[model samples]
Target: MRRFERIHDIVEPVEGYRRGGYHPVHLHDIYNQRYEIIGKLSHGQFSTVWLAYDRLLQQHVALKTLKADASKNNKELSTLRHLSATNPDHPGKRHVLELLDYFEHDGPNGTHLCLVLPVMVSDGEGMTVNGKSHEATYVRSISKQILLGLDFLHTLSIVHCDLQPANIMVSTEAAAHSETFLQPPEFNPARWLKGMTADESAPNYLIATQRRRGQLDSADWSELSVKIGDLGGGGREGNHRKSVAPTALRVPELIHQNKTWNASIDAWALGCLICELATNEPLFPLGIFGLSAEQIDHEHLSLIGGLLDGDGQINETFVKHLTDRLPPDFGAENIQHLASFLGLMLQQDPLKRMSTVELLKHPFLVGDIEG
Candidate 1:
């Protein structure tokens, strides 16, 4: 009895958290040893991503600094670990974002967990791989790489809940570290230029002209590689939102109160974003505060929904799952522009919607001249 009690004491504490919480990892909180938190780039509900420098490896990386919300962080860590494990054998998991190191930091409120991500290109916002701003080509490059990343995640039965230009990064040999820099170089505003210089434009280019290359260069898009991110909303879904896109670049099932959403939802969002990127505009420009193109954040959704709905009289039971109310009167005409393309992706019925794999084969992407 005493021996069992002794054994129980030793095992209980270990099992309590190592099993109940955390990523089954025991790592250091040292900055220089592992990574140097450079600056805060973006913040999410549970984590703040950092522009970090890896001292050991000596490279620039984006670090997801998680605020220990307890519930949220625990969930993210476990899922990432699970994906990393199950993903090893999955064909889709190959060469995505390789988990380099895990660590924690002391915070005023509590301890914060962090994940280090490799920095691709600084061409986010309007920036481009060439340091100058361009369009079309950059959009195609971003879309194709994102597709590759999604394809891998889909193979593992994972749906990246959140994917956007802000989440995707550009990877290129030209973008690689120069050994001394050992990180994605910090862009100098004054140094930003347009088009390659004379000699460099051909073969033996001048070093000075390299930075000014066009932002929309086909190379930017061609060099795109993807890394699926922010699984906070990531998961498998049942059919529901087929009739609508979710509030945030969502599919119909997601918006129509879907019970089961899957890779298709992710595909739907990806397509919409690609459409917006292609035009250098928001597919659903209505800001979170501002809804559809007609204004009013949640007006009729008619304009948005019209792109997908047809016949005006499909079975209500079939669509009731997608939405509870009739969408706003988008007039007799439907949104045939980008929304129409997105409409096909948001096919309320999962069977009808395009799968991530299928989307990769679409003419919208596959037939890209620039890509």
Candidate 2:
């Protein structure tokens, strides 16, 4: 066990330093004597991601380290390996994040699984410009790329249960240049750990700042591309999952605990993403300040129900609602086609949802509509 003089203001929770929790990673720490840690990228409930430079390849990559406990039953590594090996000729393959390398590292906490991935600059949230949605053309282009990525995953019978905006990553040309990508903040380990007495279990120093990247709005949309990432919640098509997707983006099947939910859940999420891209607001706002789980679920169901009739078709009310939310410059034809396109994917019945193939062929995505 390790103890500090006082808890430092680190980005991740301090309590996560306990046994079977986060590995105490420090700046300049070398893993497998090949990858050197530069800084932290992000952290989640199950893992912490770091920015590392590969010595052999002489390139920067994102190193995701899963917690000791979570690594025991994790299937993400296997799933990613399978994805990397199969279907090299598919056009949609380029839109999916590839797993470059993976290994197990034994740290003070326990054995943890480490994953090597390409460094991404931004996510779907970056697509907005100062809290406003992007141009209609840019939105459509991003939507098409995400759809193609989903197509590739669905073709492999892999279901990315979580497809929210944060998981949709965008890559920039600037990231490929070593001089620009290797920028690290000024950090002094001796200064930060000066008054603390720590064991091997504690990180030499904690990074309080996260790496920031240029916004997608500032990039040239024609050259930039997006990839579907974070497949930790993913599973085979026919598998049963107790939980899937964020509450706001959950489909009827996931909300109702349908054990047989399939790739159609991704289609439903894509519909939500399309609406969010067109308008800065989410279709279902369940992140209220003081709402219970049951209350939020009820509100979400109501919002979804309001958009579909008993036949699972788009209702007149929903058409008006979406039209009102869209940009004022959108023409009546563009709005009509957009609503129709959303109707095919956002259905109550999973079986009735449009497949990736059908969605890719729609006029909304095929450049027929000028949205």
Candidate 3:
């Protein structure tokens, strides 16, 4: 373990526990003998992310500093290690995040675990790939890549419990050129004005310009390359009996309080994600007045119930229970195509839901775009 002077000795605690009383790192602070902090990226519930310049490899990277609570840190570290091992050639596996390195840094609170990851572009929210609106073609391409990555993990019996938009990231280059990606001179953000131009008319492109962080002139939604990230909420399949997905993205089985689950829950969340990508809206809007877990489940059930049969229960033949719940103007063929797929994923019963591999071949994914 690496130790440094107590950060609290020199600085006051930040308002959030995620920072864990660590002294603020400046634009050029170096750590682990290689990385130089360039900018603060984001702060999460238990960690903070910074964009850094890697001295050893001569590239840009994202440094995730997490409060060294042994259990959580260990879980994420082990999961990342496993992923890295499974896919040593990261650039080829464009759908998965590559962990370049991890080390411990001492602070007043405790040892903080810092993970060095690829610096990915920021989509609209933390969950999306591009800030601009994607056509159905782009959505389909992105969804296929995500499914391939999920297949890789599920094959190893690993379950990414929190597979939402925030955890997915987009990269400009293919994995082959990752080492020198975003290196100095070549990575000048100011050059964006001279290189590529975005459609000013599009709302998503307008938002991207406003954010101005992680924006790339060469990034095109139609050619978007995405990766799955944030393994903190992930684990080996069947390890956690209770549901772990966030409230809005929670599966019916989780909301129903199912005791046993596998990687299938990720399929449910993927269904929600694909819908959001196509429509640019969350399928189920979250209730503002914080509802209890049960209350949330009740509301979720109501929305899904409209798509089900007599008793609104999931069963082996649940596909037969599907109804015409899609919007009236969505077109009859698309409604049927989507209902057939979402029905398999949103099944109230885990056993009834389609496997991720099977889901990849469904019409909603394989058929021609409707819109």
Candidate 4:
């Protein structure tokens, strides 16, 4: 059997955008349909998400336009298609956001994969999730949703290497007119065109307008489904020679030493994702990319000392890869106690890391799941 490679190992982004003019699938003369492209919904390391609308659906959807990386694209599409087929009744993979449609197109940049998904619009920033009875309420819901997804994937023995908020979507459930997205008179095309550029005023300005797409309701979803997007770093069982885990969400043992982990690896990521939602900040709290290992340094057995059975050099495999491996003071200076609760989850040892199975059923999340 081959050994698993330490993941997040790409020293640089792949260069592949030179070839252009990729075209997407258009059903029912979609090119002629009236749709609008809103500003960015979310942007990640390799893709940008756009909030768009369809004149026919009269609803908002998310359009993810990925950069040109053919090798990664083909791999991602395979997983996405599998997930899509499973939840013929659910989008967003039956967890958070609903997956709508998949389209491949050629553009000025290069070949692109456009994913249409449901939109979770917010009156405020950071998933203004509507219900905020308490901080733990948010923490609990977010955690359980993520854990449920992790648990589901574990059954298939697949790990979502990249698990973060920019990759997450809250549920858009029970929306009132005021809560929903509709183009008001103030935002209508007729009035929105008044301030167009002088060049846009040309007779066929619309003919030159950027191609506008529409909202895609693939199968219609109601519950808050949590779906893991971005398979760029994913791999099946065996053939572990390739790298797949994202550094930030990585378990100390897994990322640092090339240790093979099962679904439990995602439990660590689930804890981190919930921490971000609870505090509205990243759990690991990264600096620039180069300084990442230092940011998540898992040294000295300090973080998970009590949890490990053989406390010798816990996370030793993971800590050695970093530029620096000094043990954190773990006091007021090194780590803050924003949610003293999170300390229970971010354990240094993968086995000691908070288990999503136990976590989701915990009192913190159990009540909220009911709520």
lDDT per residue, candidate 4, 1-371, as tens digits?
11112223221111211233122111122322433565444444556555666567777666766665652446666766666556444221466333567676555455677777666543112442322222333444455666676655554556666566656654445431121343311111211223433221111101111211121122132333444555655666453433454455666666466646655455666656665555444445434445445545543223434333243232433233111221222122112221222444556555655555565555554432221
* lDDT digits (tens) for residues 15-34 of candidate 2: 57767988988878899889
Model 1 lDDT tens row, 1-371: 01111122111111112211222111223463677644434444454455566777767776675655454446556667776777466444633565666777544344557776665443333332233333434444566566777787777666677666555544565653422223232321111124522211111110111122233244545565545565555664442333233465755555555577566667767766665444444445555553454344344355455444543233333233222221233111222222333455655565677676766665545553421
Give candidate 1's total backbone clashes. Answer: 28
Instruction: Give per-residue CA lDDT, model 3, range 1-371, as digits (tens).
Output: 11121233212223322224333344576899899876555555666677788889888788887765642436888977877777544333557787889888765455678899887765424333343444445656777888888887787788889877777776665532343332331111111223335322111100011123445434565656778888787888868755556787887666777677788789888877766655556667768487886787788788666545433243333233322223335554555566576667766666777887798898867987676
lDDT at 370, model 1: 28
Q: Count the backbone clashes (under 3 Å) in each candidate.
A: 28, 0, 3, 16
Sort by TM-score, top down from the best: 2, 3, 1, 4
Which is the better candidate, 2 or 3, if ranked by TM-score?
2
User: In order, what is each prediction's RMSD in angstroms?
Assistant: 16.2, 3.4, 11.0, 12.0
**What lDDT does candidate 1 reach at residue 78?**
65
The TM-score values for the models, in the order shown, are: 0.61, 0.88, 0.74, 0.59
- State model 1's lDDT: 0.48
Clashing pairs in 3: 91-175, 127-165, 127-166
Candidate 2: where are CA atoms >4 Å away? 1-10, 176-198, 288-290, 330-332, 369-371
Q: What's the true lDDT of residue 142 in model 2?
A: 85
